[model samples]
Target chain A: MIIGQIKDGIVLDHITAGKSPEIYQILCLDKLDCTIATIQNAESLKMGRKDIIKIGKVIDINFDVLGYIDPGITVNVIRDGKLAKRERLTLPERVTDIIKCKNPRCISSVEQELRQEFRLADRERKIYRCIYCDSEAKKQI
Target chain B: MRHLIDIQQLSREDISRLIETALDIIENPGRYSEVCRHKKLATLFFEPSTRTRLSFEAAMYELGGDVLGFSESNSSSAAKGESVSDTARTVGCYADIIAMRHPKEGAPLVASRTAGVPVINAGDGGHNHPTQTLADLLTIYREKGSFNNLTIGCCGDLKFGRTVHSLISAMSRYENVKFVLISPEELKVPKYIKTDVLEANNIPYIESTSLEDNIGKLDILYMTRVQRERFFNEADYLRLKDSYVLTPEKLKAAKADLSVMHPLPRVNEISVAVDDDPRACYFKQVLNGKYMRMALILKLLEVAV
Candidate 1:
């Protein structure tokens, strides 16, 4: 499988297998005019199989979403066909407008304009709870 | 700038100071009277709460402060599609402090962020009711004289009982405090509370289904009504509502010095006959609630006596 390199873009690598589609949807990649390629279950030395997402343009990405979805994923910034920056993501302490609170009794449910926010309650367990209701955030890929 | 959202927001020293202030208020009421001569408190109850609303109003009045705001959402701007932040911002303009009770969890937190003044969470769904914990703390302090080395048994709906959760979180900070959680299988305390709070703090606690069995060992037995409002299904509410009832027969097994406490407006979880048993401190808890609220109001307003 031959894929062309990008002059100035982002390469999301080392994503957990079978998580690229959800990331694509969350990032709203379909709305972008630039080209985007997603590779699934690619062979890797570190991970047996991993997913990768390549963007043909350097677009603003919500790092919180990526960190929350898969903290182990690596984000590489490509500028002028060279790797400008290689950064690893860790779980964010706080996230806003990324995930909605599922608790029916949460204030965010009725308040449409309210920003959905969550705080990392347990680091080891990767648990995020709604800031308003303290209800655990439902698993979102 | 300070708001009472969760019980955990207060440190052990802070709780101690609040308790001390509450006790002082009880001892010397005349000294603290008129401390807030011209201040105003807004009780913005988006939900129907007869006790908490009145308690805040009474607390403010006792401190020589005027009280304002609505009893329900219909009477307030919230009925006109006003958000909590809007209502809070509007209310904060009129009042020096705001005490809010909303059916949606974390509504007060929203209000606290934009209210511009101190906001006290009266109750927010089944999430948090820190003032009630303060009331319970005062009641416990008055009865036992100390928070340490007490076997506190929390009975009834431990699952949705915000008061029990707050009390446990508050009391767990003290030395040698133990908890005996009594509830039906369906209404047991949440695992996060057990692990994050009790276990994380190295606090020893036991869970039991029988209230009668655990009643004997408790220094303070906090009873909570299985709230019908918390249930989504009527059938589940009916089945679990009668899971535990505190009768005089059950009290016979309890310690002589045991303090029987409830949050109030209970629907037969406790027999009326047990009210005169001298162990019933729920009424005292109600009285203590006002004093605690007064102390809290003063603390938030930065008032000195």
Candidate 2:
């Protein structure tokens, strides 16, 4: 399927197959006043299978949350249909208010409107733990 | 100014400083007395807590400070549908600092986020009891004189024991600290504790069901209650309840100088007969708890300004 190349936009390439919609939801592409194209389960030699998202306008994207989702995803910026700059995502050292802690006794469970914060406890295993209780987070990202 | 929601937030230096302060308070009580003369400590215990709630009040009173707040949720505005955030904000206005004990995990964190004053987690659900860990650390430091190079055995209810989890997390930061996780298979220490705190830090540890078999190898034996409340089924609690009772005979295999500690309100886990043994330090552990809370209160209050 040919999603037309963008002149000045961002190409979120190399996303793990079947994970683009979640990213699109998180990035809120539905609310954006620009063209966004998502190609699912596309052929890729590097990843075996991949998903791609093409945004027709330049917008600030949260690299931290993106990296937390899939560290290998590439964000390719295009200017006038030519590659301008390329960036690769990596897991964030910490994520805030994105994941709720599962521990029943965790402080976040009772405190309304508190930022559910998590810090990367183990980089190698991609483990993130609640900042308040240190309980392992249920969030895969 | 920061709230201590978990023992994991404290570093080795922080732990050392707290321990030294506690020791100083132990040695020279009069010198630090009246440090919080004008301050107030609010004990917002949403759940029933006998030792923790009282010692926090005692710690403040001993520091020449006043203590206020309810001992249970029904007495507090929480019964009127007041959220923890609102309670914390309201309490923040009246108290210099707060020590909260709630049945819900992270209730203290919510309070800490909303309160203008510092918040200390006395006990939050079964998630954390840092002051208890502080008490445990002070006991270990006073008895053994160091945090490193020791074999610590934690027995009973490892799965639901917040005290054990916090203790393991705190001790894992020290060098050459090996752990013997003693519990029935059903009550084994949670897998995340082994994988995240132990293996992640490369701390050597062993898990077993029998306490007597590992008694001789330990420098410290931390006992905890096999709480009936933590068990879902009464039959499961009864079956695993008597699995590792520390009897006088068990003490025969333990080192003479072993620092036997327990976060009290124990039920049959440690025999009353074993209390006469020189190794039993649970009572002293209680007293040490007061000193550590005093030290912690002083540190947090002084920094709050």
Candidate 3:
């Protein structure tokens, strides 16, 4: 599939297959007034199969959400149809507004304006927990 | 400490030190009477938590400090839709330190961030009850002599009890502490605590629906009331309350040295007859709460400046 190349935007590459929609939905990429294409089961030299999301305009992204969903994902920034920079994500120590605290009594639930935050409790297990209640925070995306 | 939000943040050594400090104050109350003469503790309760709030106020008072603030959400600016951050920032101007108990978890954390002083979480929803856990640790050390190699039976509402959660997390930091989780399947310990705190820490633990089976081997029998507030149905609370009641008959099966503890305001979880039992230490837990609060206030105010 010719998903097209980014001229001046972000290319979210190496997304675990079948997770691009979640990233797209989470980032609200479809609502942006710019060209965005998602190619599923894309050919990869490193990964046997991957998902790629190409945005045709420069826009801000929530890296914490992207990292939480799949830490192995890579991003390449294009400027003037040239690869400006390449970025790879790792699990962050703490993230805000990436995951919701599942515990019913968590402050993030009652205090609507407060950011939903989580911390990587166990890096090996890829376990993130609500910063407030310490409950395990599942990635809805 | 800038914030006493979680018992998990406190090491066994820090707990021991605080317990020792509490004990020291207990022995010679006159020595530290005026330790916090000019200090003030703001008891900001956005929930109806009289016991915890009273314990905090009593602690501040006994330490020669002043106390201030509202007891319920309706009484405060929160009733007028004021945010916790705004209230905390406003309260910070009037009080030197804060002891907050909110129905929402991490409300104290928000206070700690903006309060411009140390914040003690009296009890924040079901997230934590660090002060109560401090009282429990002190009581356990006094009764069991050591936290190591002891079988602690945590009975009742483990799922919703912040005291049980904090106590388990705190005691797990000790050497060779085993947890006998005695509760109905519906009230089993939360998964995160089981997996993250207990399993991850490699602490030995076993779960059983029968409290009597585990009572015989326990060094500490921590009884918690099955809160009516936690149940969606009144019948469920009524049915489950009888399942965990600690009576003299049950105590007969327990070790003679077993320390029976409860965070008070008991809604018939323990038999009133058990109050006379030698193993009963729930009343002492009340006094310990006072002393621990005193120790906490002194520690916070000592470094407040």
Candidate 4:
């Protein structure tokens, strides 16, 4: 399978197998006018199989969402067909407007304008709790 | 700038100071009567609460501070679709401090961020009620003379009981404190509280269904009513509401020196016959709540004695 590289764009590499669709949906990649390609089940030495997403244009990405979804994924910035930056993500201590608090009794449920915020409650377990209700975020990913 | 959003926000030293101040208020009421002559407290209760709202109002009044604000959402601008932040900002302009109780969790936190004055979370859904923990602390301190080396048996609804969670969190900080959590299987304490709080602190605790079985070993028997408002299903509320009632028969197994406590507006979780059991300290807890609130109000206002 031959896929063309982009001159100025982002390559989300080393994503866990079968997780790019969620990343794409959450990041709202469909709204972007630029070309995007998702290469699934690619052979890798580090991980037996991995997913790669290639964005054809340089666009802002929410690293917190990426970190929360899969911290193992690597973000590479391509500028003038050269790897400008290679970045690794870690779980954010706090996240805002990324995930909604599902607790029905949460104040954010009724107040539409309030930013959905979560704090990393446990680092080892990758547990995030709603800032308002303290309800644990469901394991959607 | 300080707000009492969660009991965890308060350190052990802070709780000790608050308890000391509360005790001092109880001992020498006249000395602190006129401490806040010009200050105003706004009780912004977005939900119906008999004890907490009145307790804040009474606390402010006792300190020579005027009290204002609404009893429920209908009477306040919240009924007109005003956000908690807006209501808090508006209320902050009139009052020196705000004590808020809302049905939605973390409403007071939102208010605390926007309300220019300090905010006290009276109650926010089933999330937190720090002042109630203060009252409980004062009662426990007065009864047992210390928070250390005590066996606290929390009975009834441990799941949605914010007071129990707060009390557990507060008391767990002390030395040699143990807990006997008595609740139905469906109403057991949340897993995070057990794992994050109790286990994380190396605090020893046990879960049980029978109150009578564990009542004998307790230094303090904290009873909580299964709050109907917390339930989404009426059938579940009805089934669980009467799970553990503290009758005199059950009290017979309890220690003679056991301090029986409850956060009130209780609905038959405790029998009326047990009210005169001499060890019943629920009424005292109510009075202690006012003193604690007064102390808290003074603390937040930076009022020096």
Candidate 5:
């Protein structure tokens, strides 16, 4: 059963289970004044398992952060308890100002004060590359 | 431009512009010093590549920029089981731009996605080395005065040398080029390269195990180290490692103007006796690398910021 509802906010659907912490971090939800419900490990007839993040207020989505966390997450804007707009946040052509390059020797990673930037060249392959240090966003732990 | 993940994103016009910028830096070093002044470059090297690491730092320093980041993997938080993405998110808060080198394939690509700053791939496992290829292009342009219609003979470990593979892919795009792949039977150029690059494009080429036999007919002699570790048996390695060395006697057979190039950090592939020869361009290659790097830093920073 659909438990209750959000009056006015954004609903992030189709998130992988147990990824709310990262999604929360990506959206900077903790720092904001809003209600966030992260549902993980739920049974779905369509999807074997699913996750969702329901926000109580409308916040301008940070697409770079969203794309990085899970390229598959979709953000839906709810207005007056009606779905105003729902679309998958396509990865940007060039991702800028959302992530810090982890290449310890990368010029951006080494210099403590400098802000790291990477361009999202391809979304399907989930490839993001650094402009200065030439480091790529590697998903491998 | 947040990340420079692949060379495919760059058009030929882009590469030409970069080379032109590099040439400008070589001609006037003082003009571009402050271009990146006060900016910091973070270098995250998870692997040990002394030459590449130093070359990158030198590039940033020459631009009046400061350098930060680690040279070793052990010193970083990654040792404690921090994920590459999480580490990148944290590091992104600190650095303006980042360069990463990891032993794992596609590590840089992963870091690039998570980084807020510009990312440069120094070397990611053996998948791609675009910057080194850029340096090679700059070196060829500066040394040969052009990038067209010339024979490039790559000798040594063709199968494993990342430099050789990148150069071949880059050079194959040029006009009127032929390749002389010189390596032992045990260390032939990979079949994929020959099929995908040479024959597919109909670029004329020949392969041989004897460097001396092919030395006289080439315009460029590219040497790569034939490591003992690549061989299964010690006797075979001992037998073939010395077979391809460029000796003074071998140079006698080469053309008077035949240029000899090595990717560097040489380990007896090219004799010390050949160092004094005018044909040896490896030392010049090193300096050219610095100049080219200076050019790259200037161009990338200018375009992005």
Candidate 6:
């Protein structure tokens, strides 16, 4: 397990192992942020195995992406080399911005400029419904 | 709901709400112009369907939203090796909604899993066409005035007709709804329709190889095509194709109020002369498709509202 702490930034710990790339892409952190360290297959007490990404800035994070990518991730705001804020991510009750839907033919997939929106219909299964075309995604199955 | 995969998932009340919404849009079109203002609808049609695709875009346009997306598979990224899920995830980032039609079974289902936006299955391979089902329901309500105590004659290809199957499944929910399955012996209604929809549900129905023989008995004549490609041999196609044609002369044998319907882009299955007949409701069905879709959009949005 590769373990290294960030000098001055937020640490995203307890992400589901092997889901780092999806998190990286969804957050759009490839361009603006610097000194980002991504570690996978790290052992954790909470999650038998985990992934962690430490970012070196206070840039606004999209809690939605964190909620969607991995609900198990613990977002810790680090200030002056000390942990400032720590909380487990919770998926939003209603998603105003959807990243995907169960329907392949939805306009959002074809167009280059629309934001996907969904309502969390069944929280336990993570079932989401698209507002535009009314497609359902059953996350559990 | 991002993807409409199957009609079995929707309740009867859900179907009614969709139909009522479509009727409202038909009755008052202007009221929904700006309902989807600043929004966009993307249509990804892998198969060629000029009518169905247009109806979906029209539904969005009527709601004051703009439309974008491809009408054919060759014109889009599908020609490349991009997986449906990969393409869907990328597009979900851009569009607010998506409606897809593919020749492969469960293509839209795969899209729904990966898409970040809402997805509508326009039609899948001989599977489901829920939107078209809604159009049929609205057409029945508008033309026949009610769905109860009616006999529907489903004429033409039964084995491969998605519309026919969907219509039968929907009408089975109404009271005293009987089906007159009309087609050549070679093109008879599938056994699944008999065992699954009619028999399982105990809906009254009969199968026949004659169209005009029972034309006068039906309240609605539902016409479908006998595709030459669906036949195994050229001789079989030649033998069965003419068996289902609905000519104007045959109209005289039908009830005066007997409505004729076709989920159409008719290629001789229904004669052109029949278009001018008062009983013809196929063209009106096209108009009803747009209205029904508008109703669906409004209802889904209201859930979000």
Summarize candidate 4's per-residue lDDT along B1-305 as a digit string, tens digits. 99999999999899889988988998899998899999999999999999999999999989999998889899988888999988999999999999999999999999998899999999999988999999999999999998899999999999999999999999989999999999999999999899889998999999999987899999999999999889999999998889988999989998899999999988899999999999999999999999999999989999999
Model 1 CA lDDT for position B16: 86
**C-alpha lDDT (0 to 100) for residue B131 of candidate 4:** 97
| Candidate 5 chain A TM-score vs. reference chain A | 0.79
Tens digit per residue, CA lDDT, model 6, B72-184: 88888889856677778888888888888887545676688788777787887565677887788888898878889999999988866778888898889889999999877
Please report the candidate that would top DockQ against the real structure. Answer: 1
DockQ comparisons of all candidates to the true complex: 0.75, 0.60, 0.72, 0.72, 0.03, 0.02
The DockQ-based CAPRI class assigned to model 4 is medium
lDDT of 3 by residue, A1-141 (tens): 456666799999999988988899988987899998888998788888899889988788877778888899888999999999888999889988777777777777767488878889889989888888787866545
lDDT of each residue in B14-64, candidate 5, tens digit only = 778888888888888888777788877888998777888898899888888
Instruction: Tell me the deviation in Å of residue B293 in model 1.
Output: 0.6
lDDT of 3 by residue, B1-305 (tens): 46788877677677777888999988988887777888889999888886788888888888788999999899999998888888888998999999888988788887788888888888888778999998888888788778899888899999889899999888888889899999998888998889888998899999999987789988889999887776778988887876688889888998888899998889788999999998999998888988888887767666331
> Candidate 2's residue-wise lDDT over A1-141, tens digit each?
567879999999999999999999999899999998999999999999999999999999998889988888999999999999999988889998677788766667756566888999888888898876778877574
For every model shown, what is its TM-score relative to the native structure? 0.95, 0.91, 0.92, 0.95, 0.65, 0.66
User: Which tens-of-lDDT digit does each residue in B1-305 have in candidate 2?
Assistant: 77888888888888888888888888888887777888999999998879998899999998999999999899999998888999999999999999999887778877887799999999877678899999999989888988999999999999889999899999998999999999989989988889978998999999998887899999999988888866669999889888888989878988888989999988888999989888899999899999999989988877321
Query: Where in model 5 is the C-alpha error above 4 Å?
Result: A1-141, B6-9, B227-243, B303-305
Whose lDDT is higher: candidate 4's or candidate 5's? 4
Going through the candidates in order, state the TM-score of chain A alone for each one.
0.91, 0.90, 0.88, 0.90, 0.79, 0.80
Evaluated against the true chain A, what TM-score does chain A of model 4 have?
Answer: 0.90
For each candidate, give the TM-score of chain B.
0.98, 0.97, 0.96, 0.98, 0.91, 0.93
Whole-model Cα lDDT per candidate? 0.92, 0.88, 0.85, 0.92, 0.76, 0.78
Per-residue lDDT tens digits of candidate 1, residues B1-305?
A: 99999999999888889999998988899988889999999999888988888999999998999999989899988888999998898888999999999999999999998999999999999889999999999899889999999999999999989998899999999999999999999999988789879998999999999987888999999999999999999999999999989999999998999999999878999999999999999999889999999999999999977
Candidate 1 error regions (>4 Å): A1-5, A33-35
